[model samples]
Target chain A: AQSVAQPEDQVNVAEGNPLTVKCTYSVSGNPYLFWYVQYPNRGLQFLLKYITGDNLVKGSYGFEAEFNKSQTSFHLKKPSALVSDSALYFCAVRDYYGNNRLAFGKGNQVVVIP
Target chain B: DTAVSQTPKYLVTQMGNDKSIKCEQNLGHDTMYWYKQDSKKFLKIMFSYNNKELIINETVPNRFSPKSPDKAHLNLHINSLELGDSAVYFCASSQVEGGETQYFGPGTRLLVL
Candidate 1:
């Protein structure tokens, strides 16, 4: 089964500092990875995805993710974090050959302190 | 305008009662999906429809039935709601199935008392 793992339960970082939310995946064949962020009481918002192509993918809200095929990881990153960036982040993987259902990670709560 | 919209943003109902949540997508997407976000914030896919056809149905209970009246509308109806059913339900849509980015609605928070 295809699955995603976000090892960290919470990550705290200071404003303006670089932040990273780690994500690793286990899937057969090439993986389709995605990063989603959720604000309090809001639905999951798309941040970035890696289907096929360059290892680094940029997305909305100044977010970017690096896809590492060798490491089987797709980590979400931001150059400078803001207090507003504090939210829950989820890493999801889609089964390419299956029913196209997405399996999401447990989610990591990011706290960008001002 | 909201690309994907869900009715009853917050729903509080008594146990053993029936409730329904409606979803609509104006993006002209052919695929719509329902996901449940539990208290731990783990998202799980419940059902999916493509062009009014049921394509992907997970191991959801029979009490939970999804109706897709048209390509643009998908509704979830639950009978005899249980406490475990109290979670955030999100409706999403994509231009196509698989490898497509899904646009999500604000989500409906259901609380079974």
Candidate 2:
């Protein structure tokens, strides 16, 4: 079974500071990982995806994620946090060789303080 | 233009009543899916349709039925609404041939009284 775990329930960071939202995964073959963000009362928007390539994948809104095969982790990062970046983040994973279903982690609420 | 869209952004109804939520995607994708998000924000896949064919059906109850009129539309009908059925339902679509990057719709918030 493919699954993702987000350890933090909430992450607090000051504006202009680097922020990290932790995510780890377990899957059968190589994993296809994804990051999504959701604002209050809005649908989730795709941030980035790691299919197979360089370890670091850059995505929308200046967000990036690094895929660590040994650590089985794909952590979302932003060089400088903005107060508008405060939202819920979700990490998802799917098996590369098997089903199309994506297993999602419990979301993390990020608060960027001004 | 919205890529994926769902009707009845908010629904409040009594238990044992029947209701339906419609979803449409104009992205020209081959696969459409339904997802349920609980109060705690845990998302679970309920059903998926690919080109009007049932591709994935999770362990959902029989009271819930999903119908895909075409590749672009997937509608969910609930027979007997329950308190447990209250949650946010999302519709998403992706090109199955490509890497699985699903685009989501503005969710429909359903509240069963």
Going through the candidates in order, their DockQ values are 0.79, 0.74
- As for candidate 1, its clashing pairs are none
lDDT of 2 by residue, B1-108 (tens): 989999999999999999999999999999999999999999999999999999899999999999999999999999999999999999999988536799999999
TM-score (chain A) of candidate 1? Answer: 0.98
Candidate 1 per-residue lDDT over residues B9-112, each given as its tens digit: 99999999999999999999999999999999889999999889998899999999999999999999999999999999999999665689988999999999
For candidate 2, lDDT tens digit of each residue in A1-114?
999999999999999999999999999899999999999988999999999889999999999999999999999999999999999999999998766798999999999999
- The regions of model 2 sitting more than 4 angstroms off are none
Error of 1 at A99 (Å): 2.2
Q: After superposition, how far is residue B10 of candidate 1 from its true place, in Å?
A: 0.8
